[model samples]
Target: MVAKSVTIDFEFDWGSRIKSDYAITHVTEKLLQVFKKYNSKGTFFISTETLPNSEKYIKMIKNAGHEIASHGHNHTLDYDVKSKMDLYNQIEKSKKLLEDIMGEKVIGFRTPAFKRSRYTDEVLEELGFIYDSSTTKSKMRNRYKPMQYANSKKLIYVSISTIRDRFPSGIKWMNLFGTKLTGKKPYIIYAHPFDFLSIKDILKLYDKNKIPIHVLLFYTARIGSMLNTLANCIENSQTIKNIILQKNEK
Candidate 1:
C-alpha cells in the first residue's frame, strides 16, 4: 500500500492580550500531549510577536521533532499598506528569526488570517520560501485570491482545505468518512491553540466576550472528539515541507 500524506498544522496566534486571560502555555502543552500520544508530527506556524513570550514552547515543539514555520513577523494584516521593502523584511525577518532559533531552514509560510496582497507571492519568492499555505478556497471571507496568483508556479500555493466561518470543514468531513474520502491529495488540517482550551475557563476570564461566540461554542463542544478523530485519520503524516520535497522529487 502507498503511504498516506497529510499535513497537520497549528497556528499559534495567542499574543499578550489573550495571555492575560488564558494560560497559553497550558493550552499548547495539552495539545502537544495529544499529538505526542499518537506519535504524530505537525508544523507549527508561529507569529514573530509571540516568539518573545513563547520561546520555551517553540523550542519544545522543535525538540519534539516537528517543523517550525513562519506565521509572519506580526499578527497584523497590513501587508498592503507597507512598501515592497517592508513586506520583504516582514517575511524574511521572521524566517531568519525562526531559523536562528531552530538552527534549520524555515521554508514555509502562512500569512496572518490567510489574507495576502498582490505583492505577497513576489515577496515570498524573493525570500526563498519553499511553499505558502496561506490561500483558502472558502467563499465566506475576503481571503487571498488563489486564482489570480496561479501564474506564479515557482512558489507552491498550499491552500487550506474546506475552511468555513473559521472552522476546518475538511476535518469534519474526514472525521465523518475516514481516509476513504482523503485520496492522494494532501489534506491540510489547520487549527489554533485556543481551539483546545476549556470553554468554562474562557467564560470565567471574559464573560464570553474575549472569543467569538461561534468559535467558542464550536471548539467547546467538539474539540476533544475532533482531536481524537484527527489523530486517527493522520496516517503516515508528514510536514508540509517534506510533502513538497517528495512532490518535487517525483
Candidate 2:
C-alpha cells in the first residue's frame, strides 16, 4: 500500500462567504482527470451546505470511489460557534447529509480551514466519527495516531501535509507549485475545489468578492494547471479511510 493519502476539501471560494459553486461546477473534472491519470483514489471532505448547489458533483466524486467525509454543515469557524451544541450540529448535520446523499456511513471529518477547538475531536468521537483529518502538523510516526477523548472513545488523527514546511500548505499551493515541497513520506495531502479554479475566474472572483490580500498572496502564481503534475507525483494512493484501515492492520 502507498504511504500517502490524497484529500480534497469540497468547498467554495477560499473561505469567503460567497455562495458560489464555480469550482465544483467547473473544476472537479480537472481534478478527477488528474487522479485517474495517476491511478489514485482520494477522500473528499465536503461542506454539506454546498450540496444545494453542488450535489451532482458530490455524487460524481462518490461514484468515482473517493471517500466522503464531513467538513461541517456550513463551514463555520470555531470562534463563531455559539456553543458546543452548535458545533455538534455543524458536524452532525454534515455527516447526515453526506450519508444520505452518498448512501454510506460517513465516518471521517476534517474541520473547515483546519481550525477547531480542543473539544472538536471529542465531539467527533461522540458523533461516531471513526477519524478526523483536521490537523496539519502531526508528530507521531506516519503522522497518524489514535486519540482518546474524555469519553474513552478513540478517534484517529490524520494530518494534511505541508509545503516548504508551511503550516497551512493547502491545495492552492499544490495547484500553483505542485507537491515537490510536501513533507516526509506517509503524506496526507489536501486541496480545495477552488484551488483548481482557472486563473481568469480566480481573478474575477477575487475582484468581485474582495478576497483579502493575505488570501490573495496564495494565488500570485498561476493556478489551475499543476494538478496533473501533482498527481503524477502522488504514488499509489487510497482514501483516508483505507489508509487508516491499512494502518490498523499493521
Q: Give me the overall lDDT of model 1.
A: 0.65
Would you list the clashing residue pairs of candidate 2? none
- Encode model 2's per-residue lDDT on 1-250: one tens digit a residue: 4477778888876753677777788889888887887888988889888877778888888888888888898866552243778888888888888888877799998877666565786678789998877766533323232232223248777767766665434555555545654565567877777766667787788788877777666665655455654565556778988878887898
- Once fitted onto the true fold, the runs of candidate 2 whose alpha carbons sit more than 4 angstroms away are 79-82, 138-153, 166-169, 174-185
Candidate that would win on lDDT? 2
Tens digit of per-residue lDDT, candidate 1, span 1-250: 3333344334342333343424556576776776677776777887776667778888988888778889888666566566788878888888888888988888888877666777888998888888888776654455444333444678887766553334333554444445343222565766566544555665665573475666466556554565666667565656787777777899
Off by over 4 Å in 1: 1-23, 80-82, 141-145, 148-150, 163-184, 212-215, 221-224
Maximum-TM-score candidate: 2
Clashes of each: 0, 0
TM-score of each: 0.79, 0.84
Q: Report the poorest 10 consecutive residues by lDDT, candidate 2.
A: 143-152
